[model samples]
Every structure is written in structure tokens, then in C-alpha cells.
Target: MLRDKAVTGMQLTLIIAALLILSSIGYAMGRRRAVAAGRGGALRLHSRPSYHGAYVALWCALPSLLLLVLWSIAEPRLAEWLLIARLPDSIRALDPDRLGLLVLDVKNLAVGNIVSREIDPALQAAAEGYNRFLTLSTAAMVVVAISIGVVGAARAIRGVSPAFRARNQVEKVARNIMLAASIIAVLTTVGIVLSLLFEALRFFDQVPFFDFLFGTRWSPQTALRADQVGASGEFGAVPLFAGTLLITVIAMCVATPVGLFSAIYMSEYAGPRFRATAKPMLEILAGVPTVVYGFFAALTVAPFVRGVGESIGLSVASESALAAGGVMGIMIIPFISSLSDDVMNAVPQSLRDGAYALGATKSETIRQVIFPAALPGIVGGMLLAVSRAIGETMIVVMAAGLAANLTANPLEAVTTVTVQIVTLLVGDQEFDSAKTLAAFALGLVLFTATLALNVVALYVVRKYREKYD
Candidate 1:
């Protein structure tokens, strides 16, 4: 059976390779036919030979590929249905659930896997039949796909002529493909939003919407059994919201001034040699994995922060929000600095020259003219950095303890919404339970917050964007 499976796979691969070879042949033939059609003196074709060749090649490959995909999708279900229909009457009389298990056992036996039931003649015969059907289906697929490819190529080659408008047809096909891709992207996003909405609505049915939104406590631990303790869970999300806001604020405070100043220095003050060397090194921070940043926060920064707080007579937890936010800020620095530097560099050189012509120094020109010109992009970068900080999970999980405390103090342990979402959804979870559904509800809220932030950023960009001649 395993050898047969390997042979089947090899056959599919050969079919694909044959189609590619046929497409190449069609391209050459189509180009030659077009050239022959335009051979007379002062003759000109409507489109280039290349377009005609491409048109033929696409026709040769696309229909066959589409058919192969459809066949692959349908083959498994159709085979299973046929196998069930051919099962013995006694087996078919079993309940649906047990019948499903018998079918699974048959498949396992066919694949030489461990099966729940003892082997019998009937099961053995059914497994052999299943394998035979699969082998025949694969053979049929290869034949049909290859035949279609050859016929389509021949038809397309025959259609090639001086006045066929191959370029327009090819471009129309390309445009339709691009439109399909765009629709797919939009539909995927809509599907995600709808899934979240439906699941969150299910969650809201069990928990009051206003309480989930406005209540102060947020312990989402529901009991699995009736006799289990902590059956009633508190669903107030204010503490999670507070922790998210607090950490984001702390991160932005650390990132904004340092990042903006670094951008200014790199763009205006540094010599070309220094800027070129430093810019790539600065951007490398953005590529470092968040988990590494989390490790640094938990092991190095958290202890350092605790020691410093003790020395200064301040109470700091072993896992404080300060450590996580600080590390996250360092991680987000590249996002702001790199983008702001590029935006500042994109400011018109003429504007700088004008400032200098009016007797302004280099620093004054950067401050008064260049900064204003680049303000919109700079703000956009800051917004991106803020989003990155808000969505961060690893740093908070490692350095900041999962204690959802509603406090303004950065020295205390706290947990953010993202951390809770990760916690609630981890491990074996019952999907219908309020505990599991809370993750989707939290996700919906996070999506809404991010969308609102984007809207505000768009407003800021539009309001400050400068137009120059």
C-alpha cells in the first residue's frame, strides 16, 4: 500500500511537470505562428509575439490547474461516500456514530495504522476496495487534466492571428486575476470580523454586556462541573483595560522622546558616513524576536528595576509593569526612529535651502521647516509604535505578572488584555463556555480599539500633511 501511495504521488508530480513542458511548447509554437502570420512586407500584428505566446501558455496551464484543484478537493469525500455505500448491510445498520468509527477503522487498516477493532474478512476486503478506488481516481485525474491541457493549448495556438488582440485579452485576464485577489483579501477580513462578532455575541448572551464592559474585576475562571468551586466567574474588564492603557502609556513615554531625538540626530546632525553605518544597526532592533525581548525584561530588567526601587525607598514588585513597558519601548524604538528618519529625509531640500537663505541655522531650519514638513509621517510612525506597544504580549507575560490590578502605579505587577486573551484560550477549553468565549469578546474589543486608533491617525495625517510645489 505504501509503495502504491508513493507511485501515485510520483504520477501526480509527473503530470504537473508534463503540463509545464506542454505550456513551453505551446508558447514557442504560438510565437512562431504569429511571426509567420506577419511575414509579408509592411505587415504588422495587433499585439507583440510575446503576448501571443503568453496567451497560449496561460490557456495551456490555467484550466488544467483549476480542474486539478477541484478534483483534489472532491476526491476524498466522494471516495468515502462510495465506500460507505458498498459496506455490508450489517455494518450499515449500525448507528451513525458507530458507523463513522467503523469507516475510520477501515481507513486505518488500509493505511496500515493501528485499528480499534480486530481484523476480519469483511473489513479487509473493504480496505482493499478503498485502496483500489483511490488508485483508479488518481489515474483518471492525471488523464483528464493532461488531456484538457493539450486541447486548450492546441485551440489557443490555432486562434493566433495578426488581428487577434492578444495583448488586450492577456491584460483583461490579468486585471480580472488582480480583482479576484482583492476580493479574496476583503472577504477574508470580513469573515474574520464576522466570526469574532458571532462568538462574542454568544459570550454576551451569558454575561451582561454592560457588566463586561464597565465592571471593575476580571476573573474568567468558570467551573467545568457543577460541584466545582468558583462556578460563578467575574467578567469585569476594567482592570485589563487599565493595565493595557498604563503599559502603553509607559512604553510611549519611553519611546517617543528618545526615538524622535534619535531620528532628528540621524537625519540632520550626523555626517553621511556615520548615518549610513548607524541606520542599519538601529533598524536591526526591530527584527529581534519579541520573545528575546521578553527574556531580557524578565531576567535582566525586572531584577534591576526591583533593586533600584528598593534602594530609592520605593515598593516595586518582582514582576512590575515598568520592566515590561521599558523593554517593549526599547523594542519599538526602531519602528519610530527608522520611519521618522525616512520621513525627515524626504522633506524637500529646497525648503531647507530657503530656511538657510533667510539666515536660519541648520538646527533652526530642521526645527522650523523640515520638522513641519515631515510632521504627518512622523505622527504616523508614532501611531504605529503605539500600536506595536499595545499589541505586545510576551514582554508583559514574562516581566509583568498576570495580576490584573487597577492601579496607576508603574512599579506594581499588572496584566494587559492580550495576556488575558492568551491565558483564557490556552489548553483544552470548551468552546461553548463563557470562559472560552471571553477570548473572542476581548479580541473584538481589541480590534475596535486598534481601528479607532487608525482612524485618529488618519485624521492627524490628513490635517498636518503639507503640499509643496
Candidate 2:
């Protein structure tokens, strides 16, 4: 069966290669004819010879590509239908899932893969039937696709003339393709939102929405058997929110001042040579993977924080939020710095000159002129950094232990919404239960929050932009 599938794939690939070759031939023919119709001068043509070539190429490729895509999508389901019909009545009477498993086994068996059950005469016969169907389907696809490509190319080539609007045709097709791509993206986002909403609603049905939103505890494990110990499925999300807020605040505290300062220095003070060197070095911090930061926090920062706390007679968890947040802040610094620097540099130099004309010192000029002018952009950058910190998972997962503590203290371990979402969905688990569905709920909430944050940021940016502009 595997050999048959491989052969079918090779045949399809060859069809695609042949279509491309035909398109290329059509392009050469169309260009030559357009030049001939224009009396060997492209200036006399209605459109450029290149446009004529592209028009012919698109004609040759699009129909065949569309056919190949449709065939690939429908081929498997059609194969399955044929196989099911070949199954014995007794086998067909099996439960839906069991029958599906049998189909899967037959496919795997035909491909020379090990099956769960022993190979029987019926299974062997079904596998053979499946191979035959696949071979016939692939052969049909090759014939139809090649024919479409050839016809499209021939029609396009024959239609080429000095008066032909090849540019308009090609541009219209390109515009339609782009519009289709955009619509697909919009529909995909809607699908995601609807999926999350339905799954979150299912979770809310099992667990009270108010409790999930406002309750302080967040134990999501519902005991399957009543006698199971330590399975109090209290799905309070307040603690998770609080932890996320605490860590975010801590990260901002570390990132904001440092990033802003670096931006100011680089934009207003540094020379061209120094700015070129320093900017890339600072931006390199952003390129360092979060996992590497996680390791640094876990192996180095966590221990150092613990030692400091101990010296001061204060207790610190092995996986403290302080360590995680601080490291996360370092990771986000480049985002704020790079953006803030660009914004500051964008401020008109005339403003600074006018400030200096008023006998303002360099510091005074920056404070009164440059700072105000760049404030909106700086705030936007900081908001982006905050969003980054909130969405960060690896650093928190590795350094801040998964203890959803509802406290402001950075010395204790705490978990964020992302961490909890990952935990709930990891490994094999029942999806119908509130536990699995909670991941969707968390994702929905996070999505809503990020959206709200973006909206607010945009408002602030616009307001400040008007004032500055």
C-alpha cells in the first residue's frame, strides 16, 4: 500500500512539473507573438511583452493548480468510501469508532505497517481494494490536470494580440488572488474565535463562570471517582490573574526605566559610530531565546535571589517570581529601547533647536521638547513590552514554579495564565471535562485582554500623536 501511495505522489509531482514546463512554454510563445503582433517593437504593443507572458503563464498554471488541490482533498475520503463498501456486512455492523479503526488498520497494513490485530483474509482483500482505488484516482487526476493546463495555455497563446489587454487581465487576477487570501485570513480568525467561544462556553457549563473569574483558588482536577483524594476541582482563576499581574508589574519595573534610559542616551547623546555599535549589541539581547533566559533565571538568578533573601533573613522560594520577572524584563528591554529610540529620533530637530534657543540646557531641552514629542511612541513601546511579558511562557515555566499564589510578593513562586493553560492541555486527557476546556477559556480571556490592551494603546497613541503633531 505504501508503495502505491508513493507512486501516486510521484505521479502528482510529475503532473505539477509538467504544468510548470507548459506554463514556461506558453510564456515564451505569448511573448514572441506579442512582439510579432507589435511589428517587433514592444512600444507598439497595448501591454508589455512581459505582461503578455505572465498572463499566459497564469492561464496555464491556475486551473491545473486548482484541480490538483481539489483532487488531493477529495482523494482520501473517496478511497475510504470505496473501502467501506468492500467490507463484509459483519465488519460494517461494528461501532463507528471500531469500524474507523479497522479502516485505519487496513490502510496501515496495505502500506506494510504493523497493525494492532492479526492480518486476516478480509483485511488483506480490503488493503488490495484500497490500493486499486488509489491508483485509479491518481491516474484520473494526472489526465484531467494535464489536459486543463494544455487547453488553458493554448487558448491564451492563440488570443495574444497587439491590442490584447494582458496587463489588465494579469493585474485583475492578481488582485482577486490577494483578495481571496485576505478573506481566507479573516475567516480563519473568525473560526478560531468561534471555536474558543464554544469550548469556553462548554467549560462554563460544567464550572460556574463567575467562580472561574472571581474565585481565588484554581485547582482544575475533577475527580472521576468520588473516592479520589486531593481532587477538589475548584476552578477559581483570580489567583492566576493576580500572579500574572504581579509578575507583569515586576517585569515592567525592571524594563521600563532601563529601556527608556538606554533609548534616550542612544538617540540624543551617542555619536553615529557608537550608536551603530551599541544599538545592535542592545538589540542582540532581544534575539536571545526565552529558553536560554529561562535557564539563566533558573540556574543563576534564582539561586542568587535565594542567597540574598537568606542573608536578609527573608525566605524565598526556589522558583521565585522575582527571578522570573527580572529575567523577563531583561528579555523585553530591547523591544522598548529599539522602538523608543526610533520614535525619539523621529522627533523634529527644530524642536530641540528652539528649546536650546530659549537658553534651555541639554537636559532641559530633552525634558521639555524631545520627551513630550516622543512620549506617545515611548508609551506604545512600553505597552508592547508589557504584552510581551504577559505572553511569555518559557521563562515563567522554568523559573517561576507553577504555584498560583495570590500575592504581591515577588519572593514567592507564582504561575501565570499561559503556564496554567499549558499545564491543563499537556499530555493525554479527556477534552469533555472542565479541565481540558479550561485551556480554551483561558485562551479566550487572554485574547480579549490583549485586544483590549491594544485598543487602549492605540487610543493613547492617537491622543498623544495629535498633541505632538
lDDT at 165, model 2: 96
- Per-candidate TM equals 0.95, 0.94
The TM-score that candidate 1 achieves is 0.95
Per model, how many backbone clashes are there?
A: 0, 2
Predicted candidate 1: what Cα RMSD to the true structure?
Answer: 2.0
Worst 10 residues of 1 by lDDT: 1-10
lDDT of each residue in 1-469, candidate 1, tens digit only: 3654577678878989999999999899999998888777435899888889989988998999999889988987897898898889999999999999999899888888789989999999999999889989998999899899999999999999999999998899899999999999999999999999999999999999999999999888898888989888998989998999999998998899989999999999999999999999989999999999999999999999999999999989999999999999998998899999999999888999999999999989988899989999999999999999989999999999899898999999999999999999999999999999999999999999999999999998998799665
lDDT of each: 0.92, 0.92
How far is 94's C-alpha from truth in model 2 (Å)?
A: 3.9
Best TM-score goes to which candidate?
A: 1
Clashing pairs in 1: none
Per-residue CA lDDT of model 2 for 1-469, tens digit only, reads: 5775787788878998999999999899888888888885647799988889999999999999999999999999999999999999999999999999999999998888889999999999999999888878888998899899889988998999888999999999999999999999999999999999999999999888999999999888788888998566988998888888888999999999999999999999999999999999999999999999999999999999999999999999999999999999999999899999999999988888888999999999988789888888898999999999999999999999998888888999999999999999999999898899999999998889988999999998887773544
